[model samples]
Target: MTLAPTRIEATPERAPDMRLYESLVARVSRPARYSGGELHSVTKAWDAHEVRVALAYPDLYDLGMANLGLMILYDIVNRRDDALAERVFSPWTDLEALLREHGEPLRSLETRHAVRDFDVLGVTLQYEACYTNVLNLLDLGGIAVRTADRAPEDTIVIAGGSGALSPEPLAPFIDAFVLGEGEEVMREVVDVVRAWKRDREAGGLPRIELHRRLAGVPGVYVPSVYAVDYHEDGRVREVRPLDGAAPGRVTRRVVESLEPPLTKPIVPFMEVVHDRATIEIQRGCTQGCRFCQAGMIYRPTRERSVDEVVRAAGELLDNTGYDELSLMSLSTTDHREIVPMVNALMDAYGDRGLKISIPSTRVDSFSVEVADAVARGKKHTLTLAPEAGSQRLRNTINKLVSEENILTAAENAFSNGWTSVKMYFMVGQPTETDFDVEEIVRVASAVKQIGRQHIGGRARVRVSTSNFIPKAHTPYQWVGQADPATLRRRHQILREGCRRAGVQFTWEEPEKSLLEAVLSRGDRRVAEVIESAWRGGAKFDSWSEHHDWSVWQASFEEHGVDPAFYAYRTRDLWETLPWAHIHGGTEPSYLRGEWMKTLNEEITLDCKRDPCNVCGMQTLDGDCRHKIAELVQMKVDGDSTQKERLMQERERLMMLPVISAP
Candidate 1:
């Protein structure tokens, strides 16, 4: 008979040794990170709540504190009378060393209880580079690094974020993966954990029992209960469920509309990456950039009404005392009522010296109009994302942005008093050539010259490019990342060309891009590599100062795993991807069709305006048709002049051949 795995005892709740923690914090460079007493932060009696959630962002406080996703969950969990939420960020290298030397475990920020003591430890996996940090966080918290070693009473490890959609690489470590928007699924997870704990208190409950129940939850995937088989050449042959509770394909959860925005955001003690009041004016993009995973996963765009947005902005500013208010979204200018929304916000708070900021905008004069309305006081910098350089390459990626569109936007911004302009591009896109890369420099130079004509020497143009990595749920998911040598050569071309043209240029480290590609596309075997890498000191792989590519390489070799198989190998259309079992709203057929269109350099119309392109989101919730109809009705209900203008615009667009590239 096989003996059950050894059950580890759960940690008891208690306040940390304050004197030692204070001493350690005093020695660290950033003491405010561990200081915990931030304005608007929630703290409740340890025993008062039945469910205690320790929300962790596996990164430094400087960056994690700024993440709006974590903040939203924190707010949602804390609002419950019977539940509470605390936060924990990965300790910096210095603090990690100090804690290990002192034999102290990592604790939550609000109450100082060890993270292992919480009922649930919900980690946000925002990016692939943070995978190693998750292991470090669990180990530092005195919890078992792997799920198999955890006892029934140990904190349930659950992760949710964009990275969670591609959950295979981190599956072994995480007990349950929340597949999509955590707004509703989080409550379900907490309920399951709470129920399991109650059953354990009455009589011992097995860990697998809880796993089976969680697997049954919609939008929850228990990786342990699923078995994956590989063919002779090592491609995934099939991913079959071992338990009846788990579904063959875990569909992601979707929130119908973005409503009741999070106000009263926790004010950080010190600086963060983004220090401002934020409102997600919209959720999902309709532009359908083929390389964008967010576009594919967050299908059927949802928007908050203009009235709700203005109200939330007021509350956020009032609660946090932040001077700047950010209208956040995948594409902020795409909001139907964007102009009126800005006008209303300005009308309400323009006199209070409020600075309204839109973080994303399309490459058109309309975006400039939105920017001009917001930049009434100061025009700091105008930024645009023309994902690719040349028009042909752009068409391949379906960016649908032309050089003329970009230049027109630049001219409009400069004419309206903006001096500095920043344009973002992606190098190493699929089908990209040296000429395509060179076009980035030419475009930047052209924009700079246009700026010079308007604002003389004061005008500046900066171009920033990131190496392209194929994300899990996009049209480019089957393609291989460009090799480092090619990326480096392309960067050198941009650097030299930009230097000669007097345009500033910046590019990402190709090494980081390669690692991202591997982890994002990796399968079950990658878990061994990740754990080994963490053991070999691979935390903070995203940070330039701490990243050691040699360590990752050594880990790969030790585990007998080939990183090239995941990163640089083109997947056949017939091959089953590691994430094939996880449906991210978009149907595989739609994605395959988009890939074929991309190869042909064809473009797709924006479903927001034109007839539905049948991208498969319609089958999920019927939101595609409903949202499009709502948008039309909304435009038609406007004043006569505006309604007439919108009708004429739609008529003209409908006349254009739908498949033609702009």
Candidate 2:
């Protein structure tokens, strides 16, 4: 017999105004966005903790509530007896207007307290398109948007996530930026802010002193304490530390293991983009794809043991009443014991009416088998990311899979009862040519043929190609972007090809990629351009209906900064890039070497099964080669006495040091 989930009774919140909320709830779409009585939500007493943190995402509630990083931080901070954390997200356009018209401040979901009342406001800068929404959120909170204009009483705004690696565009608005994985460093940040507050109450702490203290945190970057000098041509002459405590080079912080993360994630009241209890099967990828920023920034892949993963899956489903579970990773099929892990999960929970989801499988038949085993009724869509079309281009990008491998996987999916298939490809990749664009259509066509050959008349294919945006930490960071004209040509070529073949071809708008590139590679000089765009109504540029392309162009002209200089111009090896001083695990020399390999059309093997390529992540931890080798050897040596071997492996992994010097 199965027991029902234990529900934590809801606690009453201190109301700002009952009538105002009553009116707004009736008037708003999806009133659950502002309503806060979701089951299992934690709400400590207002005076229970010494420090208050408002964990905010510069996006909507359905979007922000799905972020696992913020949820982990919320659980970690609230678990501490000395600190409390609450959730806040950028309100939708309609709700923002109503709140502003009524003169109500942006508030937290837990206690209904104004955001300005919190001691620390940590916002996740996940995307460039959300910059304007950051200012809109700040203004609604009754707090000044610029860091320079903020009062001591205003909430200390800090930004992090992937965007923080190239944070110069947002430097003027965010008080501080966290540069790496936030799991381990978040508590350090909270502790520093807490101590600073204590000293402030003692009447001895100055703002500069607080900034200096914050700059001392392992992953924290205090932009105000750093001096940026630009040449007459708008390139950075130098980015030097003005304070002694701040390091001249701010390397991103890494969490050595995944064991310490929150296992029982928070459940949302309404539908989100991805609404499922999740288990992080692994962190980082060692595939060494040159164009992938996540591959370069997240180094020396670390994975959780299969036993730990199963335990967490059971607990999360039992605690949250979620009917689905997902084993999350950059590459889910690459896990050492993925087959046995999925088998174990399905064996345990398969009969309990739980659906398991996996994303971005390897281009192999084995991954298809894993998908088949997990997709109980074939009730979900199957997605594959070939990333490129021709084998030559695949080699250039270090996507080691071959054309035969892709068709074989598609064949497997179709034979196994998957009626629909989605393949992801990229345009404007480095060294891409017109022939390469044609090859994209050719590959999709081949995939569709394979599906049709197997599924008869039930084949449905979705082919999406997005423009390549050069990110800060990848090997292609120094390469010039494909101009709008080039992207338009490629889009046209793909459209004609897919149209003749009667396939669904969706491509990214070059305008969005242009703004993304400018924001990605721009320096502190680009801050005003972002401010100008926001002031000209550039909020929600990522959304199609709300995007104002004219406003972005006007903002660029107003700032007199040419988009081509940042987005279209190729950078020299010796140039002083904006994020040159911000380390992202892998060293620059390694990235340069990888770039040379890409130009040579060379391919790198996955280091998990091969010798270490020495990308510099080894200096952070022991090689991941040992990690997978040990697990495989353990399973073989134990002769399938799985429980004993699993326990031994889990203990060994948990005992490993979180960080180590080679």
What's the TM-score of each model vs. the native?
A: 0.93, 0.92
| Candidate closest to the true structure, highest lDDT | 1
Clashing residue pairs for model 2: none
Candidate 1 — what's its lDDT? 0.86
Give per-residue CA lDDT, model 1, range 479-588, as digits (tens): 99999999999999999999998899999999889999999999999999999999999999999988999999999999888888998899997789999999898888
Clashing pairs for model 1 are none
Each model's lDDT comes to: 0.86, 0.82
RMSD of candidate 2 to the true fold?
A: 6.7
Question: Across residues 228-302, which tens digit of lDDT does each residue of candidate 2 receive?
Answer: 998887789999999899999898888767655365566677988788888778998988878888888887788
Residue 532 alpha-carbon offset, candidate 1, angstroms: 1.2
Give candidate 2 misplaced runs (Cα > 4 Å): 1-22, 622-662
